[model samples]
Target chain A: MKYVDEFRDPVLAKSLIKQINILVEQIDFAKERPIQLMEFCGGHTHTIFRYGIEQLLPKCIELVHGPGCPVCVLPMGRVDDCVSLAERPEVIFTTFGDAMRVPGSKKSLLQAKADGADVRMVYSPLDALQLAHKYKDREVIFFALGFETTMPSTALTVLQAEADGLENFSLFCNHITTVPTIKAILDSPGMQLDGFVAPGHVSMVVGEQPFHFVCEKYKKPIVITGFEPLDILQSIWLLIKQIAEKRCIVENQYARVVQPDGNFPGLDAISRVFELREFFEWRGLGSIDHSGVRMKDDYARFDAERKFPVPNVRIADPKSCQCGEVLKGVIKPWQCKVFGSQCTPETPMGALMVSSEGACAAYYNFGNLPELMALKAEREKEEALS
Target chain B: MTASVPGMRKRSGVLRAETINMSHGGGGKAMRDLIEDVFIGAFDNNELSMLEDQARIELSTLTALGDRLALTTDSYVVDPIFFNGGDIGKLAVCGTVNDLAVGGAVPLYLTCGMIIEEGLSVADLRIIVASMKAAADAAGVKIVTGDTKVVDRGAADKVFINTAGVGVISKAHKISAHNAKPGDVVLINGYIGDHGAAIVGARGDLAIENDIQSDCQPLNKLIQSLLQACPNVHCMRDATRGGVGSVLNEFAVSSGVCFKLRETSIPVRTEVRGMCEILGLDPLYLANEGKVVVVLPKADAEAALAAMKSNQYGVNSAIIGEVTDAPTDTVILQTSFGGERIVDMLVGDQLPRIC
Candidate 1:
C-alpha cells in the first residue's frame, strides 16, 4: 500500500486535474467537437468504467473500448479445438479459468468437464507442467491463453518443461500480440479512435516501442498507464491535452514499472519458445496476419494441437450478442441488445460476458454512471409517490 | 489406540496425490483414513482428533459470542504473485477474515506466515507486507503474530502467505450457507469477478491491461453493519473461488432451497465482460475477493441494502437475486430477456490459486 497509496493521492489527483483543466481551457478542447480516445489495454477500459471516468469528462471527450479483450477475440474454431482436445480420454486439458467457459461449436470446456472429460483449471502455465509431472501417463495439454503479459510465463513453462524432459506436457498456444490487434481496430471501418490509452502490463513486456507503429502510422497519441484510478484519470487528461494540441506521440505514464525496452530475459523467453503465426482467426476480427504466436517447428512435439488430433469446429456468436461492435469501439456496452437483459454474467450469451477483461463485464460491474444511480433513486422516489 | 480408523494416506510423496485422487475430501472411514495416513501421522497435531465434521476448540473467554470459535487457516498459492489490483498479501488477510466473517463472527485478529523465495526482492516483500497491514487495518483486525520463512529460489514462488484469523460471534450473528431460507433476498456487496481478472492481468505478459485491481478487502465491517440493521440475515457467504454462480449453488445445496437471480440486476464491469469474452472465462464463475452474498428475509432486504451502502466497501451493493421454493435445491438464473437457465456449482478449480 506504500507504493500504491502515493500514486492515488487525492490531493495530487486534484492538482493534476486542475492542470489538465487549465491546459484544456487554453486550447479550447470543446471546439474539437468529438475527441475519441481508444484505450488499447483492457485494464484501462475497466478502470475507466470502474471509476465512472468517462462520465466525469466533458461532452467533447469520449473514451472508446478498443480491441483490448484477448479472450473475446479468440476465434470460435480454436476454442472448439481446445474442447475437442479436452474431450480426449488420454488427454488432460489444463487451462486458465477463462478458457474453460468460452463456447465452441455448442460446447465448452466446462461442459466437457461436466460430461466427465479430464479438463482441469490452473492458475499458470507452470501449474500445467506440475500437472504433467504429477500424471506421467496422461498427456497434459496447457491451453496457453492471453497476450504478451501472460505469454512470457507460458514460454518459461515450456522451456522449463523441455529442459526437464517432461515429454507428457504440451501447450496449446493462443498468445496474441497487442500491436496487431490495435492496428486491426484502427483499420476497421467502424473504429473512430482519435487516440489510445496504451496497455501498461503489456508494455512491461514488449516495451513502449511496439506501440510506436500506432503513433507513427495512425497518428494517434498513446499513453501507457498503470492500472489504478488516478493513473487512468491522468492518462485521460494527457490524451485530452494531446487531442486539443493536435499532437501525436507515444508516452509512458506508468514509468515506475514499465521500462522502455521491457524485461530482456522475459522477451528472450518468449522469442525462444514462440514463432509468429502468419495468420490467426480472431473471434470477431477475422484472420489478422501475424497477430498470434504458435509453438516453433522445433517444439511441435510439445504443441498440444500437433500432439493430439483435435476436431476442428466453428461456432457463431449468439445472434443477439453484439460483442464484435462492443470490442471495436463501434458501440458502448449498453448498446448491445443482450447487454444486461439476455447476457448477464450468470448466463453469458457471448464471450464478452465470459471474460473478466471484456468491456461488457466492466460496465456491468463498475459502470454505475450517475444517471443510472439517479434513475435508481428516482425509481425509489416514484415508488414512494405511488 | 487403534489409530482412529487409519486416516487417508497417499502411496507416494506427502504433497503429491497419486492419480487425480478423491482422498482429499473423503468422508467417514476414508476421511479418517486420509487424516491419519497423510496429515496426522506426518504433522501430528494434538488438537486434530480428526473429528469427521470440524476441528473443535474450547476457549476461556466470557462474552456475548460463544466461548468456542471455529478457527481455520490456509495459504494462497496463486501464480503470478502480484496481480492487477492487489498482491497475495491483501488476498491472504481478506481470505482469512472471510472464512470467519461468513461464519457469523466479528473477525478480531489474524496471524500471517510468509513463505518468501530466496531471490524475491526486498521491495516486493515490503509491498506485500504493507498490503497485508493495510488489509488488516481496514478489517479492524491486527496481525497478532507472524513468521517468515525463506526457502531456496526454486522452493517457492516470489511469496506465499498463510493466514489464520480469530473471530467472536454471538448467537444472533450466527450466519452460514445452511441458514438460507425460502423467500430470502440474495444480495451481493458489489460487482463480481474483478479480483480474478485483476490477478490475471497482473501477469503483465498479457497484451491487454486489465487495469482492474483485486477487490481484496475484509467484509467484517459490512457484515457487522448488516447484522445490526437486519438480524433476519439468515446467511452470508464471500463469493470467492467459485464466484456467484457456484456460491449460489452451494447455498441451495446446504439450505435445500432454490435460488433465482436476475440477469439485469447483477453488476459487472464492461471491461471485465469484454475481457471475459476475449479470454473465454465466465465472470459468474470467476473469483471475487471483496464481494459477499447475503440472504435476508424479504422484509429486511431494504434495511440490509441501506446498511451495506452506508459502508465504504459496500457502496455499489445490490440485490442480485432471491431464495425460492421451486426446484427445492437448485439454483436458476433468469436471463435478462426472461428466459430461465440452470446455474450449477463449479466442478473443478476454474482459476486455481485465485485465493
Candidate 2:
C-alpha cells in the first residue's frame, strides 16, 4: 500500500483543506452561484464519492462529475448490437464486468447470457484472446470500450494477436477519446465551468499536448490529477491558485504517473491500430465528430464489427431523462425528472444511472446524507415561509 | 481401509474409481455404499448410525432448553472448494450454525444435502465430509440426516452443499434486526474481509500472491457467552455474503434508524484492504465466514465487548459504529479522511471493475 496509502493520508488532506479554505476566502465570492470545477474523469468522480471529498470542500467550490465512464456513455443501440453479436451461434462475446449490466434496446448482456448467449466477463483483452485460442471453432469477440488510458492496451493486444497469427480473435471497438468529448461539453450552452481536473491515466498516454487547446482557447486552468484523496485536494489547490492569479495553463498534478510528453511507444501502438471515425454516438450527448476510434483499415481482419453482421441501429434516450443536462452541469442528478422515479440503478433508463462512475449512480449510492438532509430541511423551510 | 476402532460400524471397500460415476447417486447399493462410507463413516454419531430417513428427537429435551425453535437453512457454492484455511464443507456448517446462533439459539441438529458433479473425485468427497464432521463437532451439533445426488459432468462445478439446522431460542433472548434503537452501539467480531480477500486471491483470477487465509469458524459458543454476559443485546447478524455494509443497511431499513460507522474503528487487515483497492472494490461488501455484527445499548456495550474480546473469534472485536435517529433507513460511513458518505446496499453482484 506504499503508493496508495501515501496519497490517502488524512494529515496531508486536512492540511490541503485548510489551504483551500484560506484560498477560497481570498477570492471574490458570489453568494448565489458557486464556482464550478469539473473533474473530467469517471474515476475521479468515483473517488470523490467514495471518500466523500465533496463534503469536506468549502461551500463555494462545487465539483461537477464529468462524462468519463466509457460504460456510462455507451449508447443503447451499440449495446443491442453487442448483444446481437453475442447471440450468434458460434460467437463468444467478452467484455469488462462494468459493461455487462448496461441496457441494450431489448436487454443487457447479462440478460442475453441468461437467454443462452455466450457472454463472459473478462478483465483484459488478452483473456478474450485466450478464449479464442481455447475454443478454435468458436468466434471470440471482445467488446472494447474505454478512453485513451485503456486504448493502448487494446492496441497492444491486437498487435500481440498479429504477432502470434491468431485468426479467431477480434475486437468490437467502441473506444472514445476524452479530449473532444470534454470540448463538446465545454462548448455546450449550460453552466460555465471555471477549471478542470483532467483525467490522469488518459494524459499518461496522450500527454498534456491535447489539453493545451482548453487552456489557450477556453482560458480554463486544467490540472492533470490523480484519484487519491490528497491528490485531488492538491489538484484543487493548484486550480484555485491559478484562478486567483488569473492564469490558465495545462499543469500536471499527477506528475508521479503522467509525463508532459506521454509514453511514445504507447501512442505509436495506438496510432498504428486505431483511426478516428467520422462520428460516434454517445448515450447522453448525441453524436460527436471524431470522438471515437475504430481499427485501421489494415487491421480490419481483427475487427469484430466487420467480421460479424449486426443491426447497428440508433435508439433515442428517453424524453423525460435529463442525462444531457446532468452531463453539462446544468442540473443536479436529483433535479432530473426521472432520477429516482424511472431511472434507478436497478432498472436504469439513462446511462448515468447504470454505472457506479456515473454521477447519478454515485449520488444515489453514496451521496452525503447530512448535506441531503440539510437541503431537505432548507426546502421545507422555504416552502413554509412562502 | 480398516476401521479406526474396535466394534465400529463395518467399512466399505476402498473406492473403485478415482472419480465418481452416475451409479453413486442411482439410489442403489453403490449410492448406499457411498453415503455409508463417505458421510456416515465420518459423521459417526448414534443419531446418524441408525440409518433412518429422519432423525427422532425427544420433545422434552427441545422444550427444556428454550420456548421457541429457530429453524434456518443455507446453501454453499464457494469456488476453489479447498482454500488456505477451510473448504466448502466447513463453510456450509459454519454458515448454518452462525445463522441460528445470531438468533440466540442453541443449535441442536443439522440435515445435510449435497449435489455433486459426476466426475468429482471420491476421495475429495470424503475429505469434504470429513471437514463438515469436524466443523459440526466443534459447534456441538450433530449431522443427523443427509441425501446426495450426482449430476452430469458439466452440470455442477464440483459439489454444492445445503444444510438445514434446528435450534432452540430462549424466550428472554428477544433478538432481531429491527430491535436496534437509537443510542445502540454497533460492534464487530474480529477483522473483516479475511474470508473474502482469501477467496478472491485463492480464485487465482488476479494471479496475486497473498498469504491471507479464510476466517471460517462457528460462532455459537462465542455468541452464547456474550448473551451470558449481557442478555439485552438488541440484534446480532453474521456478515456473510454481503458483509457488514449490507447487514447494517438491513438493520437501518428494518428499524427505521441510521448507522454511523467510523472507518478508523472498523477492523480490516492492511493486506485485505490492499486487495480490495487493487480490484476497485470496497471491503465493506466483501463476504466473511467468521464475522458477527452486534448492536446493543450503551450500558451493555462495555460488558458485551469485554465478553466478545475474551472469546477466540472476538479477540479483534471493536465498536465500529452507533445507531442514530436521523436519516432513517440509511447507513453512513465516516471515512478515515474525516468525511462522511452514505453506505447503501450493493446492487447486482459486486464485480471487479477493469479500469
Candidate 3:
C-alpha cells in the first residue's frame, strides 16, 4: 500500500485536474473540437474508467482507449492453436487467467478445459516451468502473451528452463512489441489523435528511447504514463501543456519507475531468446510488421509452435464488430453496432469484448449503460441526418 | 438407554482403516464404524446417537422458539479444503447457519451430507469432522443427521459437503429483501474479501505469501442481537459467494431501489486490498464467508450499529451506504476519488489480468 495509496490520493488528483483544466483553456483547439488524447495501454484505460477520471476531466478533452491490451488484440487463430495444443493428451497448456476466456474458432480455453483438456492458469511462466519439472511425462506449454513489459520475464523463464535442461518445457509465444503497433496507429488514415499517453510498464522495460519516434518523426507529444489515477491526470496535463506550447517531445511522467535508457538485462534476455516475426496478425488491426516475436533458432526447443502440431488457421473478426475503428479511436465503443446487443462480456463476439482490458468490454462493464445508450442514440441520429 | 448403564450394550464402533475406501460407504459394518467413530464421536448428541434414518424434531419444541420455520441449504466445494483460519467443515456449518440467520431465524439444526473421494486419509477426515463439530457448538446448533458416500479416486475432489439447516423465525420479525425502502442505511459487519483472499493465497497458484486468514464464522449471535435492537430490519443477507456487491445488487433489484455506497466507508483490509491490486481484482466482487449486509431505516441506524458493535462478530461494523429512490435496480459507488461508477453484478468469475 505504500506505493499504491500515494498515487490514489484524491487531493493530488484534484490539483492535477485543476492544472489540466487551465492548460485546456489556453489551447485554441478546444474551442473548435475536443482535444482527443489516447492512452495506449489497457492498464491506463482501466485506471481511467476505474477512477472515473474521464467524468472528472473538463469536457474539452476526450480520452480514447487504445488497443494496448495484449489479450484483447490476440487473433482467434492463435487461440485455436492454443486450444488444440491443450487438448493434446501429452501436453499441459498454461496461460494467464484472462486469456482462458478468449474465444477460439471452436471454443475458448475455458470450454476446452470443461471438455477435458489439461489447461491450467498460472501467475508466471516460472510456475509453468515448475509444472514441467513436476510432471516430466507431460509437456508444459506456457502461453506467452503481453508486450515488452512481460517479454523479459518470459525470456528469463525460457533461459532458466534451458539452463535446467528442461526438455518438456516450451512457449506458445504471442509476445508483441509496443513501438511497431504505436507506429501502425500513427500511420492510420483519418487518425486525429492530438497526443499519446504511452504505457508505463512497457516504458519501464524498453524505456523512453523507443517512443522518441512519436515526437521526433510524427511530431506528436507522448508521455510515458503510469497506471494510477494521479499518474494519468498528471500525464494528461503534460500532454496538454506540450500542445498548448506547440512543443512535441517524449516525456516520462512515471519517471520513478521508467528510466530513460530502459532495463538492460531484460532487453538482453529478450534479444537472446526471441526475434521479430515477419508479420503478425492482430484481432482488430491485421498484419503489423515486426509487431510480434518468436523464439530464436537457438531456443527452438523451447518454442511450442515448432515442437508441437498446431492448427494455425486464420479466422477473421465478426462483420458486425467495429473494433478496428474503436482501436484507431475513429469511433467510441458504444458507437459500434454489436457493442451492447450481440457482443457483451458474457458472450463476446469480438476480441475487444472478450478481455476486461479491451476497450469495448471496459466501456460495457464500467460505463453507465443508460448514459451510453442515450449517447449511442444521439450519435445515430446525427449520422442519419448527415 | 444410556451407554454408561451396567446392562447396556456398547453402541460405539471402532474404525481400524487408515484411509477411506469404497467399503466405508457400503452400508455395512465398515460404514457403521465410520459413522460411530468419526462423526458421532465429534458431534455427540442424544438425537444423533439414536442412529435413526432421519432426524425427528418435536413440533412443540420448534414452536417454543418461533412461529415460522426457515429452511436453507448450501454445498461447499472449495479447493484446498484446509485453509488459513478455517476448513471446509467450518465453512459448511457457518454457511448454512448464516443463511437461516439472515432471514431473522434462530438457527437450531443442520443436516450434513458428504461425498468423498476414495483414498482420502482417515486422519484428515477426523480433522474436518472435528472442525464442523466445533463450529456447530459455537453456533449453538446440533448436527442431528447426516449421510456419506465414497466415489472412485478420480470421480471427485478430496471431499464435498452439503448442509441443509432449519431455524425458527419469530412472529415479531419479518425480514425480506423486498422490504427495503428509500432512505434505509446499509451496514456490514466487518472487512470484506478476507475469505476470498485467503483461499487464493492458499491455492499456491499465485505463490503470493501473506498472513491473510479466512473470516469464516457464524453470524447467528450477531444477527440475533441486531434483530433485538432493531426489530424492523428490512433486508439482510450473508455476503458469501459474490461478496457485498452482489448482495447489494440483489437488494436493489428486489426492492426496485438504488444503493449508493461510499467507497471510503466500506471496510476492506489493507492486505486484501493489496492482493486485489496485484491481481486486477476488485475487492467489491470478492467472496466473504462471515460478512453480512444489513438494511434498515435511518432512524434506527444508530441502534443497529451499536448493537452490531457490541457483538464479537460485528466489532468492525459500519454504515456503508443508503438506499435511494431514483435509478431503480442499480448499485452505485461514490468512489474515494470523487467519482461515481455503477457496481453491476459480475458476468462470470473475475479473472486475473495478464499485466
What order do candidates take by DockQ, descending? 2, 3, 1
Please compute and give the TM-score of the first chain of candidate 3 against the native first chain.
Answer: 0.96
Q: Comparing 2 and 3 by lDDT, which wins?
A: 3
Worst 10 residues of 1 chain A by lDDT: A367-376
Q: Estimate each model's TM-score.
A: 0.58, 0.96, 0.96
| Interface RMSD (Å), every candidate | 13.1, 1.3, 1.8
Note the Cα lDDT for every prediction shown. 0.74, 0.91, 0.92
Tens-digit per-residue lDDT, B100-187, candidate 1: 8877787876766666666566456556667776787778776655545656667787778798888887766657788888779999
Per-residue alpha-carbon lDDT of candidate 3 for residues A206-252, written as tens digits (9 for 90 to 100) = 98898889998999999999888888999899999999999999999
What CA RMSD would you report for each candidate?
13.9, 3.2, 3.1
Q: Is the docking of candidate 2 incorrect, acceptable, medium or high quality?
A: medium
Candidate 3 differs from the real structure by a C-alpha RMSD in angstroms, to one decimal, of: 3.1
Best by TM-score: 2
> What docking grade applies to model 1?
incorrect
Question: How good is the docking of model 3, as DockQ?
Answer: 0.63
Error of 2 at B216 (Å): 0.7
Off by over 4 Å in 2: A29-32, A374-386, B1-15
